[model samples]
Target: MSSSQQSKLIRVVQIIIDVIFGGLVFASGFLILWIIFTPLILKTSDISITASIPVAIGANDHPQLPVEVVGATGKGIRAAFVSDAQGTLQLETTTWSYIIISNIAKLLTALMLAYIFYLLRTVLRSIRAGSPFAPENAVRIRRLGYLVLLVSFLRPTVEYFAANEILNQLTITSPSILLPSPFKVEMILISLLILIVAQVWSYGLELERDQELTI
Candidate 1:
């Protein structure tokens, strides 16, 4: 395709992504508000918190045995191992305020991601305007990469404590189970790629300045 055609196509695609990310940010905000206020408005005594846990059935003395028994006894003895002997634990809380507070890390991570997308949209706008090597764009790209790296590390820590709190709420006597690693190799790689692209943009900016001086 011609350069003009490609530019137009890219502009159209960027606009589409911008709109989608904007919508997602709006929805996330709404959900966060709902989570904060729902219990208060509805005067509900308990909010349900759900999480996955590994369960083994061979021994009745398993750490999750009490939870499993409580969950399954409601159905029948035969139905106890319905989830292939592993299942999710659901805890009800009269104190949802604390639960919401504990989950703020996840919400913050989501907000940061949305902000990154917003920055990306701005960069795309600059590109479409034929000024892709703007200094601010490089800074924004670098910031986006750093934020992704930060969230990647923060997620596991937040989830570990949150899961422990949930288990505590359930009154389960078992020790906190080791959660799976939340580190995503792909995310780290993508962050590094973005930082590299920012440096490339910096080099392009220098070249552009040199050409302008020559002209």
Candidate 2:
């Protein structure tokens, strides 16, 4: 293919990759919000406590749900409207809405990481094709990589605090017949690696641009 054709193809691929990655990131966030907030909404509709119970006592009573926020002083406590099987909304400070939210956040963060990897691969492919060094590309790629790394770093905190394996099935399941977690992660990494390669290619394109200008 002519250099121009090759460049066009690279741009097309980059656009496609961006669309897919953006979708995944958006979906992950949506799912996370749904998982975290749905239960609380249910609880709010269900429970109503008359007074604040000692957090320690309530936590022991309801181990499945934990409602403690940590801080420098000690454990921070807040009252929440919770619901149970009975159609009564009760106030409960010992309610564990955080667990639900944390589980979703963890899974969403993981998916975001995967998307970042995919974006990286697209960037690399573009670079390999001798694309011009557009600062926009570099800034975006860097921002995405940093964001993914930051999310991954926070994942452990979720595991440490709430540590619920709620969305493990949803997350672990293959979204497509051709894609599994291993494959997905692999593709994402490859995409990112390609993006890095693209940077070099972009340099060449700049040189080409300079040569063209001289001619």
Candidate 3:
């Protein structure tokens, strides 16, 4: 494509990405507020818990949890709110640790996403300015890689403890609650790929600088 056409295309895509990013930030912020002020707004001290099943199942049928919620028995319970709850919404001080840890991870995730978005936008703008091999872009990409790797491990570790607390406290019969592993190889692979790209980008920047010096 022509230079002008490429710039326009990049601009359009950047705008679309920004819109999505904005929505994500807003939702993250709102949910965080809800989690914090849950006692006042919901008039109950209900600590929110979101649990997910493994993506792949064993040979046996999906373990069904005996729950009153619709599709929970068959489909299995994904998320359950734990509180001294039945007729009233109440928060237990004992479970406060779970809420705090979970929310800290949430806040980190939001910040990471915002940082990634900023780096991506800056890189795109550099490309539109015909400086795709700029040194700063390499640095940004490296930072992005590090950010992903850091969060991949850190968030999971934070969640492991939080989930452990819940499991130790409550006895979930149908579907058991388990602590998640801290090591995630997939995110490590992704971070390596990003770092590799950054290295290649840095090489290109060096070549560009050499060309300018020769001229």
TM-score of each prediction: 0.71, 0.40, 0.69
Please give the TM-score that candidate 2 achieves against the real structure: 0.40
State the lDDT of candidate 2 residue by residue for 174-195, as single tens digits. Answer: 2111111111354457556655
What is the C-alpha local distance difference test score of each model? 0.66, 0.49, 0.65
In candidate 3, what are the lDDT values of residues 107-135, reduced to their tens digit? 77777777787788889888878889988
Ranking by TM-score: 1, 3, 2
Clashes of each: 0, 23, 1
Error of 2 at 51 (Å): 27
Better of 2 and 3 by TM-score: 3
Instruction: Estimate the lDDT of model 1.
Output: 0.66
* Candidate 1, 138-207: lDDT as tens digits: 8888888888777777765576566555555554445434333445688888888888988888888899
* Sequence-dependent TM-score of model 1: 0.71
Off by over 4 Å in 1: 42-94, 98-102, 173-178
lDDT of 2 at 71: 43
